[model samples]
Each structure stands twice: as C-alpha cells, then as structure tokens.
Target chain A: MSDALPGSLVGPVEIVGAGLIGTSIALACRRAGLEVLLTDSSDDHLRTASGLGAGRATTPDDRPQLVVVAVPPDHLGAQIARALAGGAVVTDVGSVKVGPLAAVAGVPGVERYVGGHPMAGSERSGPLAASSALFDGRPWAVTPHPGSTPEAVALVEALALLCGAVPVRLTPDEHDLAVARTSHLPHLLAALAAGALADAPADHLALSGQGVRDVTRVAAGDPALYGQIVAANAHAVGALLTGVRERLDAVIEALAGGDRAGVEAVLSEGVSGTRAIPGKHGGPTRPTGTVFVAVPDHPGELARLFADAGASEVNIEDVRIDHDPGRPVGLVELTVDEDRAEHLLTSLESKGWVTHR
Target chain B: MSDALPGSLVGPVEIVGAGLIGTSIALACRRAGLEVLLTDSSDDHLRTASGLGAGRATTPDDRPQLVVVAVPPDHLGAQIARALAGGAVVTDVGSVKVGPLAAVAGVPGVERYVGGHPMAGSERSGPLAASSALFDGRPWAVTPHPGSTPEAVALVEALALLCGAVPVRLTPDEHDLAVARTSHLPHLLAALAAGALADAPADHLALSGQGVRDVTRVAAGDPALYGQIVAANAHAVGALLTGVRERLDAVIEALAGGDRAGVEAVLSEGVSGTRAIPGKHGGPTRPTGTVFVAVPDHPGELARLFADAGASEVNIEDVRIDHDPGRPVGLVELTVDEDRAEHLLTSLESKGWVTHR
Candidate 1:
C-alpha cells in the first residue's frame, strides 16, 4: 500500500467488466491475497474470467473496499457512477481521464472516485488475453480530479503498486494532454503515413524497406478501437495535428522552392526529438553502438548466435533481424553500450563470426 | 554474369570512389575472382581501401573493362562523365537515377552508361564500413535510358549479380518515382512526426511507448544526408506529401466535427496498406501468430529461450522484446506461422516456460 494512504487496502475489491484489463486486475488482486468480486455484461466473459481463477461472482451481500470499473469508453461513466453508488472508493481504467471524471463530478460521494490509466496493452483483447503479469513494471497514471479525496487518490496509487506498476500522479487534464502528445498523436501520424501506400503501384511497393515498415507497424491495429481512442481525446489531438499541419506546409514549400536548409532544419529537429525520449529503466538516454552480423536462417542458428554472443558477456540493449528475401542468411543487428562495442566486436570476430561495427 | 551480356567480366574493373559503396563493390568483385582498381580524391581513403584488401590503387596503365562511379551526388555527374571518357561500360550507384542519367545524356558514348541503385545501405559511411556481403540478396534497381545499349545494360545487371543482389529493371523516371513513394515519403513523415516531440515537456515524454519509438527510429538519421536524398526526389516526394497533407486535414476535420466514421476510414486504409506489403521471400503475405514469454534480464537468458524454442522445430519469423524497466523480466514475442503457434506454446509450456498466444 502507498504510504500516502491512511491505511492498507483490505478488500472485497469489486471489478466491473471482466475484459482484459478488468480480469488482469482481478488476477493481480487475487495474487495479493485480497478477495475480489467480478461482473460483466457478457456472461461468457464473466464465466471465462472466473474459470481462469480471476475471482468469484459479485453478490448483493458483498461490501467492497474498492471498486475498479474497466469497461469501454462509451459505458465508462455509467459504470463508474454505478460503482460509486455502492459507497466504495472507486477508480476506472480508461485511456482518457477528463470526460469520465466530468461524468461523475456531480454524483453523490464523488470524493471517493479517482481516474487511472495503465500504460500497458496488447493488439488482442478480451479476458482470454488477460495475465497477472500484464502490468508488471509499467506506468499507471493516477489522475485525480479536484473533487477526489486525498485518501481516494492514495488508494488508487496503492492499487497501481499492487499490480506491479509504478504510479505517476497527475491531474486529469494533464494526463489527457500527456497521452494526447505521446500516444494519440503518434498513432495518427502512423496512420497518415501508411495511408499513402494504399494506392501505390506494385513497383513502388517493391522498393519498400525497413524504414516504411517501422513507421507503419502500429497502423495495423484495429480501426474502430483506435477511432474511439482518438475521438475521445479530440481536443488535445486536434491541436497537435494542427501544429503538424503547419510543419507539413513548411516542408512542402521548402521542397517546392529547393530550400535545402529548411528541409535540414526539420530533420535536425527530429534528431533532437529522438534524443529527448528517455532510455530503458526510465533513465537518461545513453550512447549505443550497433554491431551487424550475418546469421544463417535455420531453427538453431539464432540459438547458436545468441549463445556465442552470450559467451562474450556483453549486455545487448536491443536486437533487430533484417531477413533477406532472396537468400538463406539474415542480418542481425545487436545494440550495446558504446564503450563496450569494440570488445564485443573483437570477441565475436575471434569466435569466427562475420561482424561489422 | 547475366546471359543477356555477350560475355562475363574477366578482370580490370575500375571503381571511381573508395567510399562505403565503392569499396563494398570492389570487395564483391574481388571475391568473384576479378581484378579491381580503386580510386578516390583522398589519398588516405585510397590507402585504407588498399590496405584492407578491398582493391589495389588505380593507375593510368590500367585499362578497365567496366567503371563503377560511386561518388556523392554532388560529384556523381562529373565522375560518371570522367569514367565514360575511358571508353568503358559505365555505371553509377546513386539513389536517384534520373538526375545522373540526365547529367551524362549529352556526353559522347552515352550508349555505354547505365544507372544502378542497390537498395542496401548503413548509417555509417567511409571504407571502414565496407563489406563483401553488404548487398547480399538485396534489390538492385537497374535503370536504363533510351540510349543505353543492350550490352551495357546487361553488364550492369551482371555487376548487380556479382554483388549478390537481385536485379530489377525499370526506366530511370520509374525508379525515382518508386523510391519517392516507398522510401522518401515515409522518411519525411517520420521526421515530421518526430519534430513535434522536440519541444515537448519531459513529463509528456515519460509516457512514451514502443509505438512512438518505432515510428521515430529513422528520424534520427543524419539530417544533411537525408535532406539531400529527399531533395533529389522532391518532385515525387512533394506530390506524396501533398496527398498526406489532405488526409491530415481530413482527419483533423473529422475529429473537430466528431466524425468517428471519417477517422476510422483513414485508419482502415492504413490497415489495407500494411496488408499490401509483400511478405518474406517476396511472396504473398502469410498469416502469422506471436507467442509471448517472460525472460529474465540477464546475458544468457535469450540464448536459453531461443535454444528451447528451437527444440520445437518451428521456424520463427520475427522476435520482439518488451523490457520492463522496474522489473528484471522482459517479455519476448516470437512470431511464427499461425498453425505452428499452438504447437510452440504447448511445447514451451511443457518445457516449464510460461508462454501465451
């Protein structure tokens, strides 16, 4: 439990909507040795969640210390309001915070309500995809509205910690704006970039490489679900999109007029932006070097290469495999600390691997 | 050598630059048992290429049968013109073919000139990054103009084969347009998206996820170099950017008007675009499934995981690792043929490894 809370959570925790998030939370709470009551509009989902040992069915006799509402955006306000009517400290796991917070602002016992958004998810949905470890080491935004009580906010933060996530406190508006900049805007850009390829000729498509693939990877997500998410944060996303439009116009004019300096300025800003992202472990970014090695494509080849790489005792920060369509060999790029790159390269070369830094 | 050519290249290939591409071509030619003569304006680069055994220094007495111009875009025209003066079957490895082809159009013996662009590269430049396997199984676009002789085009195609690249024939203008749609446009979009993050608050950036990281990866490339590449194909790229801008405006308008259907239409188009990309082996895309496993953040953990995975005898298509910053565990996603996913999951679980499909 968070120290800011007056006391530890001893529950009967009620979780509404036994979907991916709800079931996962139920599993986590059960793992923490708390009693959990689960419910969902879908009987099949509720049955599956219970069968997976997430929790038992809720009853009118049960009095929960905490109520977690994890449902779709359209039903969130109603579900949260209904949960709060049970006179329990309540929180809802929704991507956007302000709308839901506004929905229940005038409800009775509004001070008991808080908003949270877990920074973890998958392309697949439903209770079948739920895991107790889903939120392990992820960021869970604890968004408190002006009407939220201090104890309610602390309890929400404690729930985040109980699920093995780090709780980041913010006002509801700030959380919405932050996710709008980081998540919604990037997704919109990916979709826009990928949409250009829809009508391209086959010859043009043949020229595709890793760059286009990376930029459009996330655009393969479900359209309706993403539409709901983006629409919910329209105010923040619209502002960012407008700013991007201005930059796009600038680039268009620059290219039209052969203004090389203008193009470079935009590219240079991108470089700085990449640098601004925090590195692994939520720390400052560190300089890294890449070593490329050719690996034969087979069942055990990657295992052998990884074993050999492991023998060198270098911590690989990241790995990328570039498969050659016309050959049996794939190029594997391993990223490591800059200072130790030379050592890893020499070690791999000594082991008869064809490596290049 | 391509059968389209009259005969195979015997010896005495002249390379007009000692940079990454030139030296790599030189090494590939040498590996094929041909004599390579290398030259560069910088004596240091020439000495280094020679010392690395990529090729020997060029001399006036060396009468080469082929000349490969691999200089920067600024010097490509002059060098290709100079190479043609030696009365050899001439080709230049540059990204944009139309510009260089136009530069040498008026030169005498223009029938001997062909344009080639191998779709393989690295961020690092210079002779030190040269490798014989750099072009292995990659596409090499052979752009022949109206005046190019059959023998000259065939010889250029043979050069592509010698470097282990698949030759795809197209007109010079078509090649430019292809790359403009596939490569240049995606790069510009990535830069535009990343540029928006340059002035963002640190708090906002802390909410970053893998989606943002993948989308912005290529935006970290050298600004000046990318500026030149994009500028060279500005006509095609500009047209694509205009299309993208219209779509962006539509999305903004859709959001402002609360039109969820409009937003979803754009996203649905992006989904279709991703589906249109050719799968591995340049074949039709096949259905694939991913199995997720928890891995400890240690040196040999990957080796052990891969070794275990190989025991199932299922071919892995791709791998992605999602590291949890606050924990020692990283989630590794292994993509494989869809039908094999269940077998792999069962096998991994039997081996006492926790896995999910």
Candidate 2:
C-alpha cells in the first residue's frame, strides 16, 4: 500500500475521530506511507478503524507532526482546539467552516489550525464504510483564517494532495456561503421535495419514474445527520432558502393564474441553472447529445456496445441505462460531445446496433 | 417486419401530429403489423416520419379503425374532436387529461374518445427521435370520462397493450391529480431547484457532484414545452406547489431558528416521501446493499464485472459508475439484495477485484 503513496506525506499523524471521514483519511494517509494514530471517544469506533488497517492507538512517545479533527459539527470547534494544543499543524474535516473557526478563534495556538472539508461522501457512515479512495479526484475545501500561519495552510493542502484530491482555497465566510448554496441548500430542498411523497397514495407513487427518483435521491440520507449539517450552516442556508421561497411563490402564483410567460421565465431559469454546473474535471459544461442504443439485457452486450464506441474513436462523456421492468432489452443512452454524436450514431448503425437520436 | 407486430392491431391507423410522441406511436404501430397513415401540420415532420419508416402519408380514402391524436396540449381538444368525427375509436397521448377532456366534452362523437398519456419520453423531440420500443413495459395512463363507451375504452387499452405498455385506467380527474403529484409536480420542482443554480458563482458550481446533477436533470428539458405542460395542469400543479411552499417555509424558519427537531422532521419527511416511490416493476422498494468494485477505465471492464457478479448468482439491481477524472480507474457501485452483498463482495475479491464497502 505504501508503494502507491506520495513521498511528501510525513508520518506520525494523529486523527481525532474514527468516523467515516476520519477513518477514510487515516486509510489514505496509511496508504501514503504515513504512520497514523486513530482516536475516538467511543472505543468501538477506534477499534474498528484500527482493525480496518487505518491506524493503531497513539503512544505517548509518538509526537505527531500533524493532527486532523474529523468530528460532528457540534463538537468540531472543541476538537480543533484540543488538537491545536498538541502544537501540531492542525486541520479539520467538518462540513461547515465559519462557525467552527469562530468558535476556536480565541483558543491558544489558533494560528496552527487550518479548516478543511472534503466534498466527497456516500450515504453510508461509520468506520466500516471508510475507503482509501474516498477523496481521489474530489474537491477538498481549505479555509484559513487570517490569524493562521501560511505553514499550517500549506501542510493541510499537502495532506489533501497526498490523498489525491484537488485542494480549493477560500476564506472561511466564502466557503460557508458557497457550500450553503451548492450543497446544504440542495440537500434540504431534496428532503423537502421528497417529504411531499409521504402522504401520496401508493398507487400514484407506483408511477414514479427516474425523474422523481433522481430529484429526491439524496433525501434518503440520514435525517439527523443532514439536520445537523444544515443547522451548522443555518444562516447561509436559511438566506438561500428564503430566495428559493420567493421564487417558488412567484411560480405558484403564475401557475395558479395560468400565465404562460411567467411559467416560462421560471422554467427557463432552471435551464440556465442546470447549465451552470461544470462538466467532468471542472471544465465548462459541454453541450452533449445522446445516442440511444437498444442493448439486449445480457451481461456482455453493454460491454460490446462501449467497445464499439471506443473503436469508433468517440469519447463517451456519460452513460445512462433505462431498463424497462420485465423487458429483455434496455435503452443505453450514451452522452458524447455534440459534434461527434452524428458520427457515433452512424458508426453504431453500421455495426448492427439499433440507434435512436 | 410485420412478424414483430401483434395481430390485434387493425389496418389504416390514423396518427395526427408527427412529433416525438406521435411519430413514436406510429413506429410502434407499424411494428405491430398495422397500416399506419401519418399526418402532421408541418410538412417537414411528415417527411421525416416517412423517411424513418414510420408510415406513409394519409389520403382521403384511407379510413382508420383507430385514431391516435398525439399533439400539443392546447391543440389536443380540437385534434381529438376531429379524430372522433372519423367514427374510429380515438385516443390521445397528451401529458394532461382533464383540461382537454373538458374542452371536447361538447364535441360530436366525443363518446368515442379516451384520454391517454404514455409515461415515456426523452429530452429530444421531432420525428427523427421516434423509437418503436419507446413504450416497452412502461405505464400508459388511459383516462376516460363517464360518457366513454366500454368498446372505445377497450380499443385504447388494446392499443396500449399492442405497444407493449401496461394500461392503467383512471377517471380524468383522478388521472389529472395523480399526474400532478407524480409527474408534473416533480418536473416543476426539478426546474425550480435547477433554476436556483443560475446565479451561483462559477467556482461554486465547479464542485457540484452527482447529487446536484440528478436533482436538476429534468430541468434541462425544453422550457417552452414544459411551460405548456405545467400550464395545462396549472390548477393541480399550483395546489401541489402551494403545499410544497408551505412545508418549505416551515423548514427554512426552523433552520434559521436552529430548531433541530423541526429540521429533523422535514428531513425525515423527505426520507419517507422518497421511500414511497415503488422500485422496479412497481414493487416495494427493496433494501439494497452496495459493493464497490474498482474497475480500470477501459471498455469491457464493466461487462467483466457484471459477468463476474452473474457467475456468483447475484442479480444486480442497479449500478452507478463514479469516474475519477484523469484517473486510470472508476468505481462501479453494484446494488444487490442485502443478503447477497457480502457473498458477492467476497466472490469479486477472490476474483482479483478490489472491493470496497
């Protein structure tokens, strides 16, 4: 495992939590040839992480060069302060930044702390769910307060790099507000939208399609956890929700009055909004066209189709498979660069695949 | 070609509006051994449909046993009335039901008409986008007013079956309200959620992940067209939106006030709402466990993994591939029945696959 690690990662690092993020970070650090020490308030969590090859218990003689605090938001500030007391370059992996930074502002050795959050996770939690590859290619936010030393910030950025993540730097306030709009608010709205289905007749819900499923997927996450995340960033999330409410009210009123233009404006806004999300690797969102190929529901069929696309020199940007229940065929939609879509369709057709635009 | 079609379909089926749904229906009918007569206001569309082997142009002497009016919502009333005047068992594939039904209630021969909406579509439109397999195993709602004769309703049901779709019967009012909650409301909310991203800073959106993408996927649909669908069902949609707004306000206020319990309620509600959506084949949602297999970023690797899983006697319920940009590997998450997850993981691992929880 250490063979794959970067040479820049220093050993003897201390992780203050053994939860999902903490254990995953430890595993990444361990894979990066760093000596990790795992600790958590619960002995079960600590043992689980240690057994998973994340790290062993810290010894008194092991003076760490870096300390990572990965705890719940409510306890993050205190944990950061505790880690900073060890005189190591301290950082955190909390979801929200500004609140915790402010709470630790007056603590001793505050300059040794840099706030960080990796924008990568799954619905699962706990040490058992940890994986070394969790942070790979993900965006990790590093927010440093003015009182922090440049050395501390650099150390945190280096750690993120060692984990194969792209570190994005922003001020604490900016980071909180940005995440409020991009992450927290979206989660909340997903929950809100999904919550509406609770009382719907079962027969109606049986007709739900991919549209509703995709829209509400994140709402199925743990409620208490999401509540805490939103609560931690309440001010920013609340402000954004207010804006959404105002816009929604207008849409509702327009819809109630049957105003076509008014409804169009709102719907158009959605188009522009979705278009703003960057494509793969943070590139500008490309206009991609889809080629729908009907693939027989067999294991090797999808592989053959993709192989054929690859042979044609068409790069597939994204793929979605729509499997009709009880059917032996699936619609495999391949999203490719718009300019190459026609070529791909013709190529696939010539190869005996049924293609639909 | 006719061998692929069912024998129940009669000859000389008339289809109005050679657009996406209309053209697709024509292709399905032609595949079902029927003599299809295609018509459209736009000559270009008619030609395109004909070029695609949907059907030949209709002549005055070409009488129809069944008539399908797959036109825009606003024009559906007139189109359906005209089709009904031909003395055929007429049906429509409009998105909305009650409004069009009410509009054509006074038309002569209205008793021959039944309102229908096929729960199948794509973002693309026009005759070139038609597919004969578009409706396979999907639900097609058939709504009839009290005046609808049993024979007329049976013909519409037969049409749905011939297209390989399950026909679900509902009163016009019930169909309108059910679709308002299941289809129309979800579409509008997706648009509203996506619209929220329009003014966000570019850098903020650069970090967006699959969560945001899934939530806003439907928002990328044609705005003018969606506006019309929402407008036609404005009354029902407006009422649903109003409820959403009310719940949203409560959640926002709770977040602003740091009311953890209140926020939890909203989040938990989302969990329940999403759970109400039936899984594959309209079955209760199964609790699935995922095993993450790291596959190299190359064609045929996914096929190998699925083949491996199939060999293990595990049926994969769903799959999602998370590709790390510029990385040599992608993580393929396979969801299977909870009981079989551990066995699958071990089997894959023994087969030299890198498995994660």
Candidate 3:
C-alpha cells in the first residue's frame, strides 16, 4: 500500500481486536498508507470496524509482519501468545501493561512481544467511536521486559511514531505504578468525591458550579469498564488510593481537632503538588494570568472574541467558560502568557469588550 | 446621584474592608447611580479602592443607609456590629455565614443585619482585582436569622439584585452545610489529589492529561486564603471529608482484598453522583455528543472552529482543548446536543476540517 511507514514494519499489520483501540490503530495505520487487517471475537465488531474503512477483515492466509493485540485485559495474554505462535512481532494496547506482560512471560516467542499503551481515550468506547488521530500527540507507553528483543521494541516504537504519538519508555512495573499515581488514583478519587453527591438534596446540587464539575467530571465514565480497569491494576492502584486515604484522614483529623498547622500542611502540599504538573507542551508549570470577558451565549460570540484576540497578536494559552446558570451571559476566561495578559486585557477592553481584570 | 436602585436606601452606601468583594460591591452600587463611601483597616487598601473610583473615603459625618462589611471571616462579626451600631442596615459578604452571624447575634442592632455570600470570585484577591460586574448572573446566598426584620432581609436581597445576582434564600446553618458539600469538599479533595503528585517523578507527571488537570485545577489556589476558608467552615467541611475518607477507605479495602463487587459499587455510586450535577443553565443533565477536530497550535484556530460551527447553526454546549505534549497540534472536543453532533461533524468536514466522529 504505502511503503510500510518508515521503520521496521515490512508487511501488513494485523490487529486482532476491532474495539476502540484496535480500530483506532487500524485507522492510523491505514492513514499512514500501510496495509491493515482486522479480526475480532465479535462478528458485529469486525463488520462495523471494517465498514468504517478501518481495515479489511483478516483472512486465515494473511501473513502479517507485525500484530497488535488490542483486546481486553483478560484476553490479552492468550492473544499475544497466539500472535507470537503465528510468527509475528506482537504488541498489546491494553491499559495495564504489567499483568498482560506477566501472563505472556516465558512463552516460546516471548522475545518477539513488547507492551504498549496509548495514553488517550474518551469515556465513550467501541469502534464507532474510534479515530485515526486519537493517539496523535499522546504518550504511548512502551513497556519492554528483559525477554523482549530490541527489534520488537523498535517495532512498537515505530507504530507509536506512525500513529503520531511520542514513545515513552518504561519497564512494565514502572509503567503500571506511574499510571496508578497519575491516572488510576485520580479516577478513583474523583469517583469517591462524586459519590458523596449521590444522596445530596436536589436544592443543594443546584448550588454546584465549575469546581465540582471539574473535580467530578471523570466520574461519569462507565463503572463497568472502570471496574475492570481498576481490578487489573488493583495492587498498585490500591496502594496509591490507600496513601490518599491516609492523607485525607489526617486532614479530617486536623480539621476536627482544629489543628491549623496540620491542616495548612496538607492543603499547602496540594498547592505544591498541583504546581508540579507540567503545563502546556510538557514543560514545567508557569503562571498564566486570565482576562475575563463577558460573552453572551450566542453563535459567533466566542468566534468574535478569539478573532479579537487574534487581531491583538496575543496567543491564548487556554480558555474556560463559566456559564451563568439560567442566564444568557457566560464569562470567557482567556488565559495568556503572564506577560501578555495585561496587553490582551487592555486590547480587548479597547475593542469594547467588557473585561474583568 | 441617580435614584436609589429600586430599594429602601435613602442615603449613601458605606463599604468596609475595601478588599476584592468590598470594592466590587462599591463599584456596582456606584454603577447603579448611588453614592458610596469606603473604609478599610489598611490605608493602602482604602486608597487603592478609592483610586479605582470604587467610592470615596468614609468620614465620620457620613450617614449611610446601608453598610456592607466585606471583610475576612475572622473580622466579619465585629465589622457588622460596628456598622449596625452606626445605624446602618448591615450585611457581610464573608464566604461562611453561620460563624459571623453567631458572633454578632446579641448585638443591639443585630436585627438590621442580613448575611450574604456571593458565589463568585477569582483566585486573585484585592481591590486591584475587583470588578463591578463580578457578581452579574451569579448566585448570592442570603441567610437571615429570626432576629432579621423583613425590611433588613429586603435590603440585602435588593443589594443582591442590584449587583445582578440571583438571591437564594437559606438559613445560616443550611447555607454552611450546602457550601461544605459544593465548595469546601471539592476544594479539599482537589488539594488532596494534587498532593499525590508532589513527590512523583517529573517524567511520571508528564504523563498527566486533561483529567488530572481539571481535578486539580483549583489546587493551585492560595493555600493561606483557602486555609482560612477551610478553618471557618471546619466542622461542616470536616464531616464531609470524613465521609469521603470512609468511602475511599472502602474502595482501598476492596482493591487490596480483590473485591470486585465492592469496587464496582463505589465507582457506580460516583457515576450516579456526578450525574446529579445540573448541566449548563442549571437544568438536568442532558445527553450530548462530541466531535473531535485536530487543530494545530496556531493563533485563531479555535476561532476558526467556532466560526465553522456557527455557520453550521449548531450551538456548542462546551469545548475542551487537549494540547498534545511536545506537539504543535491540539485536539478540540466540541460537545453539542446529541442530534446536532452529526450535523456539526459533517459541516466541519465539508469545510475541510478533519473531524474524528
């Protein structure tokens, strides 16, 4: 097809599951002008994914140079073993790397397999929701054990590159533990915080605003799907969650005892922790100032604001919409480089935009 | 001065503490064509507020019909008492209601006081950060005790209306508990979650995405100010955090013991809880669908997208920008009414947008 994307990939790439990750990988491969073949346990999934031009359905005679097993955690081991037996370099896109790698350990062709997880997804799942660009600009964790060959790891890394993802190297255990802290822990905590609102009074919830919305946004994810994810990485996630629980308990105890220093310690730790998160482009966090402009909830209003910002030549770092409940007005907070924020604010005000400094 | 803003006020309004809230209230009152006077413990603050044309410096001869004590919680009671003794209808814009109201409960002119907390603010605080339009279309909770007269309650409600805020009525205790859930709990949990990132490896933290960012966004708030806010609402906030801790402990226990059902129960509860939060405009949550578009990091890309959507006549409910680490492109997720999502996707595609549906 398209001269097999600039790496170790020499022939068609076979994907053995046509779910969201699998179909997405297929689409990305196809977009790269590489031949792709897809298979799935469900006939409907295969038909749906192929119908969407993800790839043609796989045939028994198809001899792929590389295979991606994009199946659920419980089936990843068997699928990897099967792909390796078929004489293909293999990788799996399961969320948890350690367990899947562990299951495939000591298999006859173990050296041919590397573990990969594209760190991107929406709450929605299935091939219908898949996109070729899903992994673009995302971190695709490439986990290689001692048994994996250099060529095998390179193939997975090549796949990441072709998919427009940056390859992040980590050992299986390290990857799992890192995700436990950054992803799994936050999801569980979000769920915990959101669960507290399940029984709150109707009027009480009417008071909810952007803060609660942001904190609990991920809690709307499918519990069944998340339950499976958490179960696979339970040991690591459990440890992290336990750590958070202890911190939370200390905070409660401090507040209960009116221990101001203890309370301040925990809250200030949060400030420091959030400060550690990389800002735009994976750099260290830098302060940004906001210029809030009152925008009416109508078509072209946001467009006009951004156009005005464009005219001012001040690059917007980020934007947040704080809609006034039951009102036509929203506050569009434009975050710009701290140095440029004042210029942007004054420019917008000069353009007759009512800006809140 | 223009006629009093459809209220009982017959004289100039006096504002104390000249902070962000106080100065903002003064500006709003002045915008409504009412004369105002300002006082603060710090001369710098008084000067800064007056210099912004918020109001004039208060003098002993000033006889104000209404006095707003927009001071810190610790000083709210005394300020309200002082204002009431000066024969002015009094209210305080302290975040917490019960503690301050209790402090001035038996003062001779307590009947003239009503309690208010405007549900709006920026992380920045001071007269420099104040805006006359700050409270426009926001909720301003009005808490009146039995000692409050009808006229006093009307005066405070009228202030809220003049400030362009919707007045929500609740008892002081009811207000405290409600905010403990909506505001206080989310802040604590955000801080705790962000705290987990403090010791993480830089590389590990680099793997974070929008989910972590949203959950911990407010964790960047000034710890000293938040500490004070938390301290004033300690009992209510502590009780709620304890409940969250218990729920989190249950999750940790389930994960540690490999109890799938227990973990599922907690996660499912989180889903239900988040579902309870009102959507935009304070209506019940509705089904929305998203269309993703790849936008390169460039000035006015967002404006272009919104322009296209506007042309398509699809009202966007919300928009989120997911900046890809180390890439020039970001993914823009446009959420819209479910039925309109397809129209938006097709419309963007027609306009040469590579949309991922």
- Winning model by TM-score: 3
- What TM-score does each of the candidates earn? 0.96, 0.94, 0.97
The DockQ figures for the candidates are 0.68, 0.55, 0.72
lDDT of 1: 0.85
**Which CAPRI category fits model 2?**
medium
**Model 3 vs. true fold: TM:** 0.97
Arranged by TM-score with the best first, the candidates are 3, 1, 2
Number of the top DockQ candidate: 3
DockQ of 2: 0.55
lDDT of 3 at B70: 88
Candidate 3: lDDT over CA atoms?
0.85
Report the first chain's TM-score for all candidates: 0.96, 0.93, 0.96
CA shift at A72, candidate 2, in angstroms?
Answer: 1.4
- Candidate 1 stretches greater than 4 Å from native: A1-7, B1-7
Clashing pairs in 1: none
Better of 2 and 3 by lDDT: 3
Across residues B1-357, which tens digit of lDDT does each residue of candidate 2 receive? 112233345667889999988898899888877889998999999999999899999888777878899888889988888887777778999888998988889998988888898888876788877888778777788998999888778878888888878788888887878888877777777777787789987767655767778888888888899899989988888888888888898888788787999999988999998888887666667888988887776655665676677778776666676645435566677777888888989999899998777
Model 3, A66: alpha-carbon shift in Å? 1.4
